[model samples]
Target: MTDSENIKEIKKLGEEIMIGGVRFKSNVLMAPLAGYTCFPFRLMAERLGAGSAYTEMVSADALKYNDKATTKLLYTDAREKLKCVQLLGAVPTVFERAVKSDLIQKFDVIDINMGCPVPNVIKSGEGCSLMDDIPRASKIIESCKRSGKVVSVKCRIGMNPQRIVIEEFARMCESSGADMITVHGRTRNMMYDGEPLYEYIALAKRSVSIPVFANGGIDSKEKAEEMMEKTGADGVMLARYGFENPLAFSLLTGREINDTKLSLILEQIDIAEELFDELYVLTYIKKLASYFMKKQPGTKRYKLDLYKCGKVSELRELCTAIFGSDDNAGLV
Candidate 1:
């Protein structure tokens, strides 16, 4: 392909749109992982070209009752311009109040958490457990829509192997006034272990008129491209793979995954330093070092040293020694 053709292909692959007037510049999104996807991490992902980023799932009940820790998860940096907050709860009133709260209004989008398969979430009749009760789930979506923010629902295919109800549930979400829907192709019972069922996601996509984003097991650019082609999804939301490589967005858009790795690590470190103190920076660096070590040679040794380093200066020295220079550390 010619240079112009390559640029066009990249643009096509990284296209964006406005859902309920909220701007999303790319189709690839960073999924909200429980302990990850904090403000600093979201900002780093956005900077690396994720079209959108969501806060890890917050409790609707906790937000309504003013739980300080839960509220903290809702916090965002100024650079997280395309922010979406994900809320998990089965109670209609709590979910309603949480979405209507002034804090939630600060976000560009509000995502309902119906895909999480954790026991705590499922036991409460929230998350994936809601799939068995479409009426209750529909009511929750209706309540969220009343909050006046763009409402989106993220859900798995079903509760177990015998129940793949994504198409029906997705249709219900649309009928309930949800602005968009995200379908993680694994059933609740499958969790993260098995291959995602793309056929189920395709069914959901066909059932909804609003944009449908496919999620689950998208770890590499090749897999991303294949999923989009196979399911005909409007976008793909990435989870664990994003934590391991923030620049997976650029890679999915057909960018050359060369030196961009180091740049993103430094960028994340800078963001962490600005958001918290040196101690937080040290912690983030160690976490990030482990992630990067997965791909680079002798990374296990670097990760061990990173974990042992107590000071930011020590971590910086270790990074310099390993990466040589910081010139090529950003996203491609």
Candidate 2:
């Protein structure tokens, strides 16, 4: 078959996926971005065509203790039907408490984050470090499974030394009760700096009994289709590139982004204001513009001007000037 024909086949296969009998509308998942994958971002991704979304990796210990701030990350709206919450912690006891806690009980699926490469997360013996100890990771899965909820795991292929244990690790997760596994195709040491090892992801897909999703370096529709064809993964998860272009999700699924980038920025501003205080909201709008304005000429100057604005009105005026004053451009 030709490349276009292969993409068509992949798109048809991507329509929906079932994991542990829990069905998601599509298989194009939004990988959990620590500070950015909040309710509003998830909502926007879903609106743009993400099949499923994971919460920013929350601390299981925080949830177990009923920490107010941590509880807020569990926030959801009516539109996010296939809600999945990813938890980070090294202890089975913490996970047990989290699964039984009210905050986590609301999610449709529970994901364990064994993929984070951040120093703090790894130093605590959580995140990608778990891949080094399959037994402990298994125990964590078992703990989450006790809730009778669909349990899943997200992990990197290996650690600094690059042992290539993804295939073995995935099988262990499946045997230990993981409904699905997401393999970020880089060793913890490589950390998003290079191309993803598609062969390792393919190994993971072949090794697991349950569903496996391939993540990393999937920045375009072509990359999505390529990963799907190369690894034969059940799904593909979008990360950094999705952060830069929210409409990339819709485009990946062969869907058009009918709205202008300016309108999306405006919508992001509204969502930010609703979810945070004025100062934070202003900062968020500017941060978002940093990505949204990348394709515009004199991008540095635009960002500098946006960063100088102290109030929402200044931000609005700058956006209007940059994107024009058409209010109807918001329609999608």
Candidate 3:
């Protein structure tokens, strides 16, 4: 692609749009990542450049029962630009209640997790296994749509690698009242391995009029552009790569966000401290610090030291020493 063409595509990515009656500031979004995507992380992604960000998948039954831990995961505030929750479950009735529940009703969008490849989730007949049962998955989507929120689905191309179901599954999501669909370009058996089949994602986009967001293996502007060009997808959902570099939205769209991973890490620590106990804050930041410092020189030592931090102050001190002094440690 020419330089001008690349620029145009990047411009298109960050452009504002109306998806499911909700106005977003950009098209690039932070796909939900388990153990991450907490309120602080989502807020950071949005501030950095993501048009929207999703909460880690909340279990429908847990929501219905008002599980405290699950409810806490739904935390958000005015700082967030858009609120979205990804629900994981198999029972349509449970999904119906979860969407209507007070905890979930505040969000602008509800993305159903039909693509998660975790073994436990699959065994429960939820996530990717739902693809094997079309009628049930359709009912779950319909149920969530009734709540009046813009409902979306994230799913793999197929359950078995032998046969890809991108087109058929996407149509099912749309016809079942999903306002949008995200096709993770991999099968259940493949998990997160191999190259994402660009052609299958293209088939899904062609099959549905609703906006299609392609997920998997997109970590940079070039890959994002390639995914859009190959699949004709409306947007790209940055999952693993997104959390690894929360500034992905800014980087991918060429947005001028004045944030270094260090600064963002400190900011996350502050937000997490307010909502969580000291122990929780310390442990979470330690894990997050590893992601920020990934592949950097002396990263192994930093990870080891972070885990040893018994106090949040110690973790903060370690971060400042490691990244604050470095100045230009991964900026966006």
Candidate 4:
């Protein structure tokens, strides 16, 4: 099909996706990125047209133990009409306790993390490790589903050179009561360096009756449209691309990015101030700025300076220089 024909087809299937009983407004979802998809970031994506958004993976063990930091990650506001918290860890009892907690009960959906490829997550036997033992993973999903919230799982294609077990794994999750499944096309060993094996995602889509979302390396609107057409997934979840283009969801939906880059950054700073102390706000904003400016022209000369900024004001000044006025240049 031609590009317009492809987009026309996507528009029909990508409008919305239902998981369990929860209905999201759109099918362009923001994936649960480790450090990037916080409250402010979710709000930004939702405003930009993400049908749904997920929290960064919080540790189920941490929530079970009442860790203050983990509790804080559950923060939300009215703007995030459709949001889910992604929890990491392998303990069923711990996950059960977390699901039953009052804090977690606030979310309409609870997503379990079984796709992380980071060594630390693997060493803890929580992420891709779960794929090695489907029985144990099924138990965890059952435990989370007991809370009466819409439960979902995010997993990779396979652990390694093994057969890409996504079709079987997705079926296992559905049988275990997972309302939806997200399949990252890369194997655990590939990390983020390769093309997502869409064939595997397509297999999972065919195997499951529940909603399936395709994730991993969907970095542009064309890719989003193409994935939907190729895999017939219910949705497309964007990760690293979101860090560079917070408005990607809008673009996928054929909407323009409506805010200036400077405006977007300032708005995030405001939300950060409301949620954290000065130290945290500055550190987090700098981290976000690093990703936003990584590919911009003239950044190599001032990247270190931007990193060294200790306050939001200094960061704003640097961004003003790089992005110029809002009327002249936006995040595009």
Clashing pairs in 2: none
Whole-model lDDT, model 1: 0.79
TM-score of 3: 0.94
Q: Which regions of candidate 4 are displaced past 4 Å?
A: 1-14, 325-328
lDDT of 1 at 285: 76
> Each prediction's Cα lDDT score?
0.79, 0.81, 0.84, 0.81
Give every collision pair in model 3: none
Pairwise lDDT winner, candidates 1 and 2 = 2
lDDT of 2 at 96: 96
Give the range of the ten consecutive residues with the poorest summed lDDT in model 4.
2-11
TM-score of each: 0.89, 0.90, 0.94, 0.92
Arrange candidates, best lDDT first.
3, 4, 2, 1
Give a tens-digit lDDT track for model 4, residues 26-144: 88888998767889888988888787789999988787667668766888867679868999998899999988887788889999999998899999989988998899999999999
Worst 10 residues of 2 by lDDT: 2-11
Report the number of the highest-TM-score candidate: 3
Query: How many backbone clashes can be found in candidate 2?
Result: 0
Each candidate: RMSD: 5.0, 3.6, 3.1, 3.1
Residues 268-325, candidate 2: write the lDDT tens digits.
Answer: 7787777777886786677666766665454565667887899887887887776564
- Cα shift from native, residue 41, model 2 (Å): 0.6
